[model samples]
Target: MITIEQYVGKWSENEDWTEVRQAYAAQLLIQVNKLLEAAKKAGIELKNNPNTDSLISGTQYGGFRPQSCPIGAAGSSHKQGQAVDIFDPQNKLDGWINDAILTQYGLYREHPDATIRWCHLSTRAPKSGRRTFLP
Candidate 1:
């Protein structure tokens, strides 16, 4: 499981990752961990290797995006600390994840075609409200 620092990363003025740390460190992190554990139990191995600019070495941003950071769209779940992007360079995750599993986890992800290198999973539903929706 990723730490709150890994989720918040080096963004905005919140260098301490205190912004929304309560939620991400507690609830969001648990959800992400359980989902990942389920995936691992299914024989899916997610490598911890993504070239991201985060404080945590050898880790990518788990979800939270500071407003000062230029990443996701405005009003994005990430900015609200409700999204997580798991590194999936091989695209194995996107291929393996289906609507049933998403429903089971109560999570949503960007469509496979839209997110090529990483699996963008979010606690927030997309505008389309699909388990896997277009970004």
Candidate 2:
């Protein structure tokens, strides 16, 4: 499981998103942790946050991005603290996960094509209402 600090990125590049992310950390943890547990149950190892003390060591996007981050849209769910992009170096999680697994966790994911080496998940519903949606 990812700590709130790692999830929120303690030393953010902008520093402005730290406090804002902290405000959403607790609630985000409740949602993201469930999915992490689900992944573990599915035999997936989400040990992406190896550097517990680092600023942006959470994932490829490095969790809780500020507006300045170049990864997602300005209005993306990540900015709202409603989404997380887990580090799946070998694409195992993305390839293995199915609709049933997503429904079991009450979470949704971006299409595997867009995800590549990372898996983008969110508790927020997509406009298409799909378990695996296109961004």
Candidate 3:
């Protein structure tokens, strides 16, 4: 689990979000933990090397992205603190894992296209019963 400070540090540097940061951070962390737990149960190992900018480091873990970020998609769940991009530069996600296991953990990969290798998991609400694309 990452600290709220770690969660909001990058964003806070650009603006004063003291009061609202905790709420977003908490929601993000909850989902992150849930995913981690599910990975454990599914016998999947997450990227853990210190050099990797991953959820384990809370650095470039692909959590909230400021609207200014070039990669931030319009109306993206990432802007709402309800999404994360999971990727390991050295290895792809375990091939044994499937969509069913991710859904069971309250996470849905926003994109399933084979070319889009990274896992974009989100907790966006009012789900449109849609599961194959990022907003």
Q: Record all residue pairs in model 1 with backbone atoms less than 3 Å apart, i.e. clashing.
A: none
lDDT comparing candidate 2 with the true structure: 0.70
In model 1, which range of ten residues has the least summed lDDT?
A: 53-62
Question: Candidate 3, residues 16-126: lDDT per residue as tens digits?
Answer: 343464476577678667767667676666765353344533345466666666666655666656666555333345353466756666655555453244566666543
Tens-digit per-residue lDDT, 1-135, candidate 1? 566656766653465345454564456667767888888898987777546543122243446666555776766777777777878877888888999988887888889898877788777777788998987
C-alpha RMSD (angstroms) for model 2: 3.5
Candidate 2 lDDT over 73-104, as tens digits, reads 88787876667777776788888888888887
For candidate 3, the TM-score is 0.66
Better candidate by TM-score, 1 or 2: 1
Off by over 4 Å in 3: 1-3, 16-22, 49-53, 56-61, 90-99, 114-117, 125-128, 132-135
- TM-score: which is higher, 2 or 3? 2
